[model samples]
Target: MGNKQFSQAQKLTILKHAKQIGPKEAAKVAGVHYTTVYEWKRQLKELGEEAFLEHQPRRSGRGEKEITPEQESAILQVWNDNPAFGPGQVRSQLRRQGTTISIRTIRKVMEANGYTAKQKQNQVSAPERFEASRPLELAQMDILEVTINKVRVYLILLIDDFSRFILGFRLLEQTSVDEVIQLVRRAVDQYGKMEELLTDRGFVFYSWRGINRFEKYLENQGIDHTHARPHHPQTLGKVEALNKRIKNELFGQEHFSTLEQAFSALTKWVEHYNHKRPHQGLGGFLVPAERFHGQEQKALDDIANSRDVTAQIQDIERSIVNLVLAPDGSVTLYLLGQPVVIKGGSHV
Candidate 1:
């Protein structure tokens, strides 16, 4: 059986042909050497038809030292019991149990044993589009539409764009100019006037005819103002972001039939947003109020001390009377100028 290759039918046919005819002619007809024909003839005579069959050779290398089915099942069982254990850890554990296997082989075993790799599902929503550079440099205001007792109501929200601070907010039955003006005055009175107030070009903001009272008041007080682009609510990104959070995270499930209930809920939510919640935009994940006015207040105090108080006061007084007319019909007039009559109206 040492490299003596021949098919069983072929060996039988060759033996039959060799017995019938001469070996040389049979070998030529069988398309084999004359020595092969003689060897087949001798095998058929000594061992009969069984000599045509073959047998597997015995292995010599570390024959079948690989892991058994039981060992593979145990590895999978350990993986199922301890999901945190990866292939390498499972392999190490198997080694400790006297079952030697490479990590790559263990990985293959795990994959075959229902440990198929799958990608993680991502469902987290994306963050807002806009961002602020500095604290209190910009503020966003928005009016949210909601229903109270089946009647529509608007929630006027004034939020600081930079620090995400809810400066002032009010719920109104109507989106009237008076309501918005009151909210703006409340914010200004509480936290000194802001440098810039960013808002959307809503009817309340544009005042229907583009005669924005809020903008006019801010201009009168020398505060910069801006309105968001038309139909682009994301321009006032901070307020819009806060409104969404309030609606979803805070007031999503709560059913409030009264304005007072909504106000109370908003108060609590605003407190949480200002003090408890950590803002990723702020450094160290600090609260918006803390970063917006905390250190800046101290710095402003230090600067205020060095600034000339009298000159500042005089400059403010002068600015107030910059639009006033003098008795001689002069455009530039001070508060000390005498009152005059211009077209039957008093001007001081």
Candidate 2:
């Protein structure tokens, strides 16, 4: 793959002499490799000086079939209409739309027709590594910027690194330590605690007050906690990529009037994102949720059990008081507005 520089006249002389004489004697007179002289002779005889400056034709084994200009224009129009649709999806959809074209043909058409894929480019230039081998092993948390009423609102995102699933999110007025802590607690309470929590060294994440509380709580629960290197935001690429997609799909090209509106919209979009949106990172463009939680066959009884678990979260907070269910199946009410820890049981 490396190139050796040679002057044009030297190259031309080498070719002329090598073709007239034998390779070995020509190489001896030219003071170069016999193979090099033979290569130059063949290139000059077949391709002339252009071969010296440009790459030789690669052996593709078989030539591609020709596609009509109309087909190419159709591909371009479809691609331009849906900016997010990549070649594989476009090809599949084109086939569904009555086009008998392969994905490879679509890719070739994309290249020839100047419809290149949109790459999500980051401003920063560095590689940050974070690895989670098993599902629920680690979750990366971060905040992204959004606008509501011309005032910026922060989107708190928690993503499972292994599953590439946006675990949970909340649109908050500010990136306060308390808000992050509360969201994290809600996530752990809902998803069963993760083994480790990874976050960048932001003010909310690195504050001694909040960090101490989180470290103490994680230690108590035997969970590992880590901080990404300062200034290296790419350390949490999964969360960052999720934030990008969510922003575009939910709020792109639209302005929000209030945080409430943004939050409600985001909640709806998140549900669709987790349940319906096909992911390019996951092979064959499968839904992240389906891949994260295996698409196993569930019976009717299993469906009911899932509904029961979900009904726990839908309990009306307004109709409920601070009451605990004891291990012996007894109910005890605590003083309203008092901060008391309710251990290992639901509060209503």
Best by lDDT: 2
RMSD of each: 27.1, 15.7
Q: TM-score winner among the candidates?
A: 2
**lDDT tens digits by residue: candidate 1, 1-348:** 122344567567777887788775886676654545554555566675664445222342322234455766877775774454567656544543445556655665665444645567796665457665444456778898877668788888987776687888887778876788788788767665666778777776776665677668778976677877788676776677778777765556578888888889888778756653445555422445554553324323433344312112112211112243436775532221122346756443
Model 2, which residues run further than 4 Å from truth? 1-83, 89-101, 104-130, 208-211, 296-348
Clashing pairs in 1: none
Instruction: Tell me the lDDT of candidate 1.
Output: 0.61
- Per-residue accuracy of model 2 over 1-348 as CA lDDT, tens digit each: 122345656777766776678666876676654445555555666676766546433443332244555676677766775556678866533443445456766776565344556778777656755566444668899989887777877999987786676778878777777777788788767665677889887777766554566566667876677888777767888888888877776678567788887888788777655654445565433445653453312211333343222222223121122344667896655332122347776443
lDDT of each: 0.61, 0.62
Off by over 4 Å in 1: 1-133, 208-210, 295-348
Residue 124 of model 1, lDDT score: 60
| Candidate 1 weakest ten by summed lDDT | 310-319
Error of 1 at 336 (Å): 29
